[model samples]
Structures are given as structure tokens and as C-alpha cells.
Target: MGWITTTWHRLGSPRWFYGMMAPWQTGFGIAALVLLAVGSVWGLVWAPADYQQGDSFRIIYIHVPTVIVAQSAYMTLGAAGLVLLVWRMKMADVAMVAIVPFGMAMTALGLFTGAVWGRPTWGTWWEWTDARLVSTLILLFLYFGLHALRQAIPAAESAARACAVLAIAGLVNIPIIKYSVEWWTTLHQGSTFSMRRINMPAVMYLPLLVNVIGMYCLFGYVMIARMRTEILRRERDTSWVVELVRRPDVR
Candidate 1:
């Protein structure tokens, strides 16, 4: 318990986290690039076509991974928000701010790809009444709302506090988004990984898993990179930042 508290406090330090994440950022970048490239090739070229949807279903490789990581990123944002309100950790808010942009991009990608998938499959580009689709759009709007809120508030602390409340409150939508397919009738499909077994064939499923992992790696790389920059911006007046800039070895 004591060590846990020490480590958690240490993680709150910008300098410590900045240095600690250096190697991890490189690893994440390399892993994401390699995994995504390989997964794309495997999913697009080699994976068997869906019996029903044909090659058009190949977009699942992109669509599923994006939505999966997008929701996961929002969950992270909500957790950071909790930390911000509870412990008043500034680093938690730094992470909350950093997560919004990429999370927004991922959510947008998911919605766009879903619409593309829907065009051929359902013969429709958009479905307003579907629970899953509506919830996902709301998720994207929440990201946009957070950004707008931050910009609207002139005071940093006030913005953080307001965003924290929004992020936490928005969490109810996550479960709604996740289970919407089950709870209501919709064009969206149910869970891919069931409690008993996978709903997909092994050959098709493997590449999707790889891309999902790659997307998560990409998310990590982006978040850490942004957080590092945010830290530098926040600590610009400090001596360490001045010394860091003077050092030629800065990466």
C-alpha cells in the first residue's frame, strides 16, 4: 500500500513521467506501425471473404478496431477525470486534455467507416433510429463538446473542473454504446467475442485482433506524445524545461 501510494504520486510528476515514457513511446510507435501494416495486408488480401457480405466486409478490419479503441480511449478519459476530481492530480487533467483529440479522431473514423459499411450492407448511409449508431454519434459529439468547453472557459482550472464533470457524467453513455445492440433492435451487430466463444472464424478473427492491438498501441503513442508536449507547455517557466531546451540530446 505504501509503495503503491509512492508510485502513484511519482507518476503525477511531469518530469518523472516524461522521462519514464521516452522508451515506451518509441516502442509503441514501432509496434503500431508494424502491426497495422501486417494486419491490413492479412485482413485485406488473405482472409477469406465473408459468406454474406463478400469483400465489402473487409472494411471490418478498419471499422471494428477504430470503434473498439475509440470507446476504450473514452473510458480512459473518464478514469482520468475521476482522478482529477478525487486527488486533484494535475497530470490526470493533462492526460484528460491530451486524450480528447485522438479520441475524437478515432470516433469520427469509426462513424465514417460504419457509414461506409452500412451503405452496401444495409443499403443506407445513415440510420438515425438505431441505438448503437445514435449512441456512437453522441460519443463523438461529447468529444467535440469537451473541446468546445475547454476553449470557451478562459480559466484553466475552471475548464479542467468543468471538463472533469462532463467526462465523468458522459461515462454512462459508454455502457449504453457497448450494449446497445443487445438491449435494442438495431442494424449494428452484437458482441464479436462472446462469453462462450468467438463469433468469428479463426482466420478472419486473428488479423482483426492484431489491428485492435495495433490501434491501442497507436492510441498509447499519441497520448504519451501529446502528454509530453502538454507537460513541457505547463512547465515552461520552470528551470528544468529551460535546461531541457539547452540540452542538445532532447528527443
Candidate 2:
């Protein structure tokens, strides 16, 4: 508990957080590139074709990861929002800004991938009766709303507060998105890999796991890079930021 508290304190300090994350971000970047390259190649070429869906099912490599990350990212945003709202931490606000774009990207990727997958699997590009699909669509709108609200507010503090409020309020949608299928009679299927047990064959599960891990690493790398940018942007007037920009090596 003590260590966790200290870590959070350090994260609340922009300079401390920036310095600490710099090296980790560099490592994450390299790792993300490697993982993404391997995962994409393996998923695209090496993974065995599905017995039932064949080549069309390959879309799961992209779609599943994007959907997972999209939901997780929103949860992250909400958590960050809570920190900012309760503690009035500027770093949390910066993190919120840094993460929203990636979340939006994930949402877009999921939607596009789902549509592509649907055309081949379901013989239709879309289905309104699919609760998961509809909820995902709603999540995209929620992201847009939060983003727009942040932009409309002029003051950084005010904008952060507004965004935090919006994000916290929006969190109610995530559970609905996750449980939508089970909650209602829907076209979408239930969870594939449950925490309680893995039900699928190893052949299908292996590539899916790889894709998921790679996507997570990629998203973390993106978030770190963007957070650095946000830190610099917010702290433009600070001496550390000015010195960083002026350094020849920084360029």
C-alpha cells in the first residue's frame, strides 16, 4: 500500500512522472513494434484457417484486440477522470487527454473490422439486433461527446473538470456494452475466452492471445508517447520543457 501510494504521488507530479516514464516509454516503443510485426505476420500468414469460417474468420485477430482495447481504454479514461476529479491532479488530466485519441482509434478499428468480418461471416455488413455491436456504436458516440466537451471548454482546469465529469458519467455504458448480449436476446455471441476457463481449441486461441498481447503493448506505447507530448504541451512555460526543446539532442 505504501509503495502504491508513493507511485501515485510520483505520477501526480508531472516532472517526476515524465522522467520516470521516459525510459519505460522507449522500451515500450521498441517492444510494441516487435510484437506488432510478429503478431500481424503470424496472424495473417501462419495462423491456421478456421474450419468453420475459413479465411473470413481471420478478421478476429484485429477485431477482437481492438474491441478489447476500446473497452479497456474507456475504463482507463474513467479511472483517470476519477483521479483528476477527486484529487485535482493535473497529470491525470494530461493522461486523459493522451488516452482519448487512442481510445477513439480503437473504437474505429473495432467497428471497421467488425463490419468487414460481418460481410463474410454473417453475409451482412451490419445487424441492429446485435447488442454488442449496438453498444460498441454507442461507445464511439460517448467518446466523441467527451472529446467535444473537452475542446469546448476554454480553461484547462475547466475543461479537465468537464471531461472528468463526462467520462465518469460515461462509464455506465461499459458494463452495458460487455453484458449486452447476455442481458438481452441478441444476435451476438457470448464471451469466447472466459476467465473461468478457455473453451476454444489451442489452434485458434494461440494466435488470438498473441494478437491481444501485441495490441495491448502497442496501445501502451502510443499512450506513453502521447502523454509525453501532453506533458510538454501543458508545461510549455516550465523551465524543464523550455530546456528540453532547446537541447540539440532533443531535436
Candidate 3:
């Protein structure tokens, strides 16, 4: 209990948080590369072709993981925003800025792959009226808004507050994205796998599970690395950062 409490307090410190995440970066980074490779190879080469979509269905390995993680990454932003608002932790704000670009990239990738999958499946590359599609488009825009907000405000705390408010408010969109297919009559299918249950066959879902885990590890690795870099920039004048910067090993 004491150790947990101490660690929680130390987490508020940039130096402590930076050092604490070193092992997580190494572990998750390596897992990301290995699992992504294994999952991609297995899904593409071994998984049975769909009766309906055939080889085209293989795109789900990439599409599912990217979209899942993109939604999750935005939730991370919302959580960070809450922390910043309640605790005024600058590190939380650092986390938000760090995740925005990555989240945006993932969202874009998901949309692109969805389009590719749609072309043959739906006979259309883009559909502005689809609930799932439109909600996701709005998500991407929310990320863009946060990025632009950061650039618009030069004052650190002021930017943090504005971004925090937006991030918190944006939480509303995530659920809409998750439930869009069900809430409206949409072409998109409900997800086939969840942590609580797998609605897919083992042979097909196993590789997807691997890719999901890999994508999450990749997110962790990227987010932590970005936060570390941001911490150095934010705490440039701190003694530990100065000392670390001076070390011959770092150079």
C-alpha cells in the first residue's frame, strides 16, 4: 500500500515518470514488432478465406486493430484531460499532446482501410450518410481540433485548460462511434471479438487477437516514448534533465 501510494505521488513528477516508463517502452516496443509480424503473417497466410468476402476479408486483421486502438487512444486523451482538469498535472497535458498525432494517424489509417474494404463489399468507397462512417469522421475531426487548439494557444496552462475542456467534451463521441452500427441501420457489422467473449472462430480470431495485442503494445511504446520526449522539453531546466542531457552516453 505504501509503495503504491508513493509511486502514485511520484508519478506526478516528470523525472520519476520518465524513468519509470523505461522498461515499459522496451517491453512493449519489442512485443509490438514481434506480434504484429506474427499476426500479419498468420492471418494472411493461414486463416481460412471467408466464404463471402474471400481473400478481401483478410483486411480485417489490420482494420480491426487500427480502429479499435484509435478509439481507445482517444479515450486515453479524455482520461488525461480529466486528470489535468482535476489535478492540474502538467504531465497529463503532456500525455494529451503526445497522443493526438498518433491517434489521428491511426484514425486516418482505419478510415483508409475501411474504404478499401468497402469498395468491393459496399460498391462504394465513401458514404457520408452512414452512421458508423460519419461518427468516425467526426472523431478524426475532434483529434484535428485538439491539435489545432494546441497550436492556437501559446500559454501552457491556458492551452492545457482549453484542450482539457475539449478533450473531456469529446468523450461523448466515443460511445456514439462504438454503438453507431447498432443504433442505426448501418452496413457496418458489430465487432466480432471482445475481451469478454469471442464471437468468431478460433482459426480466424486468433491471429486477430494477436494483432490487437500488438497494436496496443505499439500504442504503449509510442505513447510512452512521446511522453518522455515531451517531459524533457517541458522540464529542460530541471536538474535531472540537465544531468541526463550531459551524460556522455546520451550524446
Candidate 4:
């Protein structure tokens, strides 16, 4: 417990956190690249085609991972918001900002891929009445609104507080999105991956598991890189930042 507390306190220091994360960022980035490359080839080429959807079902490799990442990113934002509001941690604010763009991109990609998958499967590019589709679209809009709120505010602290409030409020939608398919009639299929039972075959799911893990690693790499940059920008006037900048060995 003492060691854990000490490490936690050290992590709260921007300089320490930045230095510690550099090596992890590099390791995760390389792993993400390799895993994503292998997973993509395996999923798109080597995996057996769907008995019904055929080759088009391969898009699931991209779609499922992005959607999962999108949801996870928003959850991270909500947790960061809580930390910023309760503990007044500047690192939490930086994390929230760092997560936004990636979340938005993933949400957008999920929507696009869903639409492409829908066109052939559902006979329509979109369905307004589909609860899952509507909820997911709402999730995308929430990301847009959060980004706009962050940018529109001029004062740094005020902006962070406002975004934090919004992030916390928007978390109500996450459960709605998750349960939408089950709660209402919709074209969207039920989850393929579940803790209770495995709905998909091993051949199809293995590459998907790889892609999901790779995407998560990619998110971590990007978040750490962005957080380090944000910390430097926010703490440029601090002594540690100044000394770190002057050091020849520090990259």
C-alpha cells in the first residue's frame, strides 16, 4: 500500500509521468503497429468468410474495434472529468483533452463502417428508427459537443470545469447505447463477444481479439504522447519543464 501510494503520487507529477511514459509509449506503439498489421491481414484475408454476408463481413474487423474504442474513450473522459472535478488534477484535464479527438475519430469511423455494412445487410444505408443506430449517432454528437465546448471557452480552468460537467452528464448515454439493441427492435445484431458465452467461431474471433487489443494499445500510445505534449505546453514556465527542456539527453 505504501509503495502504491508513492507511485500514485509520483504519477501526479507531470515531469515524472512524462519521463516514465516515454518508454511505454514506444513499446506500445511498436506493438500496436505489428499487431494491427498482422490482425488486418488475418482478418481480411485468412479468416473464413461469413456464410451469409461473405467477404463484406470482413469490415467487422475494423468496425467492432472502433466502436469499442469509442465507447471506452468516452468512459475514460468521464473518469477523467471526475478526477478533475474532485481532485482538481491538471493531468486529468489533459487526459480528457487528449482523449477527445481519438474518441471522435473512432465514433465517426464506427458510423461510417456501420453504414457500409448496413447497406448490404439491411437493404438501406441508414434507418432512423433503429435504436442502436440512433444512440450511436447521439454518441458521436456528444463527442462533437464536448470538443466544441472545450474550444469555445477562453479561460483554461473555466473551460476544463465546464467540459468536466458536460462529460459527467453525457455519461448517462453510455448505458443507453449499450442496451439499445436489446431494449428495442433494431436491425443491429446482438453482441458477438460476450462474457457469458462465445457467439462467434474461433477463426473469426481470434483476429478480432487481436485487432481489439492492438487498437487499445494504439489508443494508449496516442494518449500518452498527447498527454506528454499537453503537460509540456501547460507547464512550460515551471522549473522542471525548463530543466527537462535544457537537458541534452531528454527527447
Per lDDT, the best of the predicted structures is 1
lDDT of 1: 0.95
Question: Residue 185, candidate 1: how far off, in angstroms?
Answer: 1.0
RMSD of every prediction: 1.1, 1.3, 1.1, 1.3
144-248: candidate 4 lDDT, tens digit per residue:
999999889999999999999999999999999899989999999999887898789999999999999999999999899999999999999999899988999
Task: Write candidate 2's Cα lDDT for 17-72 as tens digits.
Answer: 77888888888778777776777777789888888889887788778888998999
Which regions in candidate 2 have their CA more than 4 angstroms from the true location? none
Q: What is the TM-score of candidate 2? A: 0.95
Evaluate candidate 1 by giving its C-alpha RMSD to the native, one decimal.
Answer: 1.1
Scored against the true structure, residue 237 in model 3 reaches a CA lDDT of 93
Off by over 4 Å in 3: none
Ranking by lDDT: 1, 3, 4, 2
Task: Provide the overall lDDT of each model, using Cα atoms, as 2-decimal numbers.
Answer: 0.95, 0.86, 0.93, 0.93
lDDT of 4: 0.93
**Which pairs clash inside model 1?**
none
TM for every model, in the order presented, reads 0.98, 0.95, 0.97, 0.96
Model 4: residue 192 alpha-carbon error in angstroms: 1.0
